[model samples]
Target: MNSAVIRLTKCSSTKCLAMFQLSYHSQPKVALDEGISSHRVQVGPHRLHYLRAGHGPHTLLLIPGVLGFGWSNFKHQLLGFDRDLFTTIAFDPPGNGYSRPPEKTFPPLEVEAETVAQFMEALGVESASVLGYSSGGRTAMVLAALHQRLVKKLVLASTHAFILPDEYKYSRSLDCIEETWNEKEKNILYGVYGKENLPKLWRQFNDFNERILKEQRGNICLHLLKDIKCPTQLICGQKDPLTKVENSWLLHALIENSRIHVYPEGKHSNQIKYAEDFNMRVQDFLMADEELSGTNIREEDIKLAKANSF
Candidate 1:
């Protein structure tokens, strides 16, 4: 990995473009029970793949992990959220799954969040509830802190608000996933990561972990937790190896209006593994916060969000 891939963005973009995906990924398949559609939108110079389902009153964004795509990660929710209650949207972040890279990599965490906000703006969504699982939760935090007005509510599951130095080595160890993967899992990996590019992908993961633990350690916006005004819920599986349950508790204690949901037998991908429970809890929260109270996101704030380009 080069230094460029690890550098953060510092430009702010106020523009929006509806784009399309030029690539595809092996994603978990699940049929939408009702009106659902796929869409592509431009964020800066990249095109993002996302899913749209239902016509509920509230807008909810389901953000996936590093390798998790919009549809595959939230397959269970494609038709789970009733059309009369919520409009659910999920997206493949840059450098992940179906959203291929013209940039060849992802932007900084800050830039990623702003790009997501711009994606919503491009789609004419003024504000939305955000749910980020694992890495996506970190993005949700940045969105809440900097682009405060765009998030109506928040749900973070197995998120990384802070990463310790040791965590880098632990993250690097994840490359062995390919070694133990079953045929089905291997197929998924082949579809999303490609078989020929395994070595390159592993190197990229190592490089990313090094940069995260060394260059960007403890910078997952924990300091900005106080700035996030939307009602937040932090969740974690008790047995999670990557991110501990205590981290969620710490996040709960920091965010003024935040709460916590701990899963006794949950792991890093608990939300997806326990999709039914997670979705149920998410719906319950969103329903209760129907009139979600938060600082109004203004045009100026959205501009400020763009200014965070690395």
Candidate 2:
């Protein structure tokens, strides 16, 4: 993959517009208050909506990716995990889905990550295992770095610590924006199979992309990556264009306890594409009864699981 000559024709032009409007506000699978439940909690100046599920000794938290909707993001992993083993929590970040929009400055990844900690405190949860995908990966990373005592394990999927390879400008380039816009958002839905793979879901995709573009600007929070000391796992889709597979490799190199896994031919939606494998790796990591004197979970395993049952 020549970082320079990346051809995103499939995601460029009107297709980018189509991808910008993707929405997951009321996904059928996100049934809160039962197997899954939604709640509103105060974080800083905003009221955030989060989903809760299962009830067990182990608590698991999931963070959505850039443009990621709550249920739409981790729905697949939720289906794979044995609910009896753990309790799971997923939330809509400020300005997305059922959560209130951020005031003045959009909730940066760092602030959102801190808010996640505050959210747990309000729920009487002392600690939990954290999983983050894409942009959510950054949030999980921030949690581990700042609130080390609260995170039992960390999983990062298709994630990056910093905008790396300065020469690799896909995301920073106008082409990236144009490419994402090409996909209509209305048809972009995420499920166990990944990104819904629908060609006409333009509005759904666009709305998501638009939100990330606006909110994520100057908000990536890369400075905290090296500070993370939790058990960590990293997963990457071999064919991911939005964030290169190399990003995973870079993360593994940076996070002290990190490990890496790459699925050949898997793209940005690989977590959903390979949901079973993702869940298995996560379960194994959480099952480890290691002393928490330090982060025992390795980095390579980060992306192995995204939304396992708590």
Clash count, predicted structure 2: 65
lDDT of 2 by residue, 1-310 (tens): 1111111112344323211212233232223223555566777776777766677678888888755666678777665676889887887776555453431124555677778888888888899999888878877888899899999889888876544433134444433333554343333433211343322233344443456446653224445666888878778888777667756765665576766678898876666878998888888878886533323334453442211101
What are the models' TM-scores?
A: 0.79, 0.68
Candidate 2 structure lDDT: 0.63
The true-structure Cα RMSD of candidate 1 reads: 11.1
Alpha-carbon local distance difference test for all models? 0.70, 0.63
Off by over 4 Å in 2: 1-34, 101-107, 165-169, 172-185, 188-223, 290-310
User: Considering only N, C-alpha and C atoms within 3 Å, which residue pairs clash in candidate 1?
Assistant: 8-310, 9-309, 9-310, 10-309, 10-310, 11-309, 12-306, 149-297
Stretches of model 1 off by over 4 angstroms after superposition: 1-34, 290-310
